[model samples]
Target: MDLYAPFVRHVVAPLHALYEGNPIYSILRELEQTQWLSPEELRRRQWEKLERMVRHAGDRCPFYRERFAAAGLDPARFTLEDFQRLPALTKADIRKETPRLQAEGMQDVRIRQGRTGGSTSVPLEFVVDERSAQRKGACALRHNAWAGWHPGDKVAMVWGATDVDSTFKLRMRNLILDRRFALDTLRLDEAMMHDFARRMRSEQPRVVYGHSHSTYILACFMKKHGYAAPTVKTVVSTSTVLADVERAEIENMFQCKVFDRYGCEEVSLISSECDRHEGMHINLDHLFVEFLQNGRPVGPGECGEIHLTDLTNVAMPFLRYKVEDAGTPTAHVCSCGRGMPMMEKVQGRVADFIVTPDGRVIFGVSILDNFTAKFMGLERVQIIQDVIDHLIVKIVRGEGFDEKVVRGFQDRIPEFFGKEMRYDLEFVDEIPREISGKYRFTISKIPNPFQEAAGRAIGRTPPA
Candidate 1:
């Protein structure tokens, strides 16, 4: 067999990373040893990195320097406990003091500017050092291995595809290195799925990865159309929360395990599922993650907001930054025996909570659960609240969808979101992606008063 793709990856990819000041191989080597370390050893390393990172942020980052002084935190000699005593970083702080938070100097070095997909109408922009970039690359390769993909496996990305004029260099890069193709989730219509399946069947890809919802829809489409990705060994989902229904359907259709990963644009990969599939293992070497409710760490099995510290990114230290998602942490260790920590699951992003005109908020998941159970013909669903008094429900109707089901959905909306709002039921061919390529289940135009991202006041629940 011609192993040209694998051979080039094995030899040249590292060289490219090194030239760009990203030590991919070096990180890989370190991870190989660190993954086997004990949990105690892992945390020890995390504290060491945290100490260094916090000190660097305090000394160099203008925003942190002020906060550190106000909190009376001596970063130079702070212990792990001392670090926790410092105030948590919020999206508002990042927004109000972005320049101060950016690491100083090194205009000659690679400082990448990144933005979160503006699911909230306001996206946070941040910079990263080359060191953090390489560390993330290393973490990704290691995580992929857990999902049964080696360096050479042909990986397919089932994500947003660009327009008709994708550049030659980008196409060649995908052809040569990725051995991968994209399935424009931007429009997963009948024509798109047919064309995509044709290409995928030809490629016989080993791994197919995409936004969790997009991947689930693809699996359902393939099953309905009598197509099979027989060579596909594993399916990986990311960017969006994979609902229970989506997960079960994807695994059932693919006839393989689905490895779901959760992270964000700001800090890179947080956690990913291994073959064990019990829970996702946190990237301990790269991040210090905490799940908190009401500003304190929640007990095991309780859902809380995700607070993260990018241990490797000194250029912009995100110390205790709230990722604005809720998830449960586990005391139970993985059977796979990785030293990294584990989280039971990542709940949806804060934006996934839909708000009504009357200030009552509902999780898009609540809609999915009720609607999917009540209505039988949805391939995929997106709920958009673009105006205060109105909602546009986008549905990618499948086998059994009809006018009867449309009326059923309308009737059900009032049960969850009270009858104080207007809504439009738009049955579309497909659910498009955000500009940043991630898919969101719920999009709200109305703003949340107290905590915009959380979509609820400090003491309020969904409307009574």
Candidate 2:
């Protein structure tokens, strides 16, 4: 029934590519075939690309040149171990040494400046070249295909992104080629959800995409109010952590598979879940990823901090960049037969980990989802650990919320956080969002275990 999708995918896309002299279409075709390469072959290719990128960065980039020399690493002959010995790039480093991070003699290439969403309250400015942009776009397309979404398919978005440029050309492109139905999540209310649900029921978009929490919230609203959302072919959840309970709720409400994606503005697409839904397949072709603990790579199934080296971005090479995220790497090969490696799971951000009074550290997600969320009459919850022995529990009340819920928390706080921990409940009409329009369910004010171990390397000072 949707004839426009085929026209946009075939004709409009190619014409736009030709008009702009963009190679993304060709690059996408190449990635489509490369996804099937053997795992060993992919790793070999990654190593080759890494070698080339390292040499380029060391020779041309002032920042890497100084860093490599200080580390006593020769780009021409350094082994993988030597490369690992190089210092991890922090957001502070990027902020301070942005100009030096850029490669020299890049006057011919088109480069653009950008900033991160500051979801962690630490925004970063960086640059990306034209080729890197094209490649990242192509990589996204390849992953979208895995979720049953193509370039031209109608996609309803519940994103809180503020980076879009609504120029006339882009508006035309969205209207014709992209066919996007976007819901701005900067300020979501019941009225907005009603309108969104109403439009979705009539439009029947092929794909639904949004921040994980925002999408889940929309689905919850629709279900509670008896709004009939269309059953799209695929739902893509990205930007924030997608908990298992939230995933189940989204799937049940939308009647489709929720493909969770992980990435950042600094690096476009890191990994995405495929049709098989086993785990997220890493984009090995574009990034050299490492899971580190105590300055060394961790074994499979063990949690570690993620370090990324972008092999594709020559203008600004991010070698062993500390992404401030934690994830568990896995050696399990996917049955989908993709040669790309998999990550067992992405643990929440490092800043989201709470430090106990007894010096034990635990992920905030465990406290929020596994324990507090099960409480009855709770519409939303945010747990803030200001100090080791105190917590501020922010709750948005739903129907039937009363003293019983407060009593429930009083009993469970000791059971979960120990007897020494004290808490104050603040009933809120709605929880606030970050500047980037994403909601953080749990926030910790104190330094985590990794911060203490890494010290200033992670740009955070540990308690003396």
lDDT of each: 0.75, 0.82
Candidate 2 residue-wise lDDT, 389-456, digit = tens = 99998999997798999998899888788788888999999988766566667787787655422211
Highest-scoring model, TM-score? 2
Distance (Å) between predicted and true CA of 105, model 2?
0.5
Q: Candidate 2: lDDT over CA atoms?
A: 0.82
Instruction: Give TM-scores for every candidate, taking all chains together and pairing residue i with residue i.
Output: 0.85, 0.94
lDDT of 1 by residue, 272-328 (tens): 898899899998898889887777888999888888999988777898997777789
Off by over 4 Å in 2: 120-122, 162-165, 450-464
RMSD of each: 5.6, 4.4
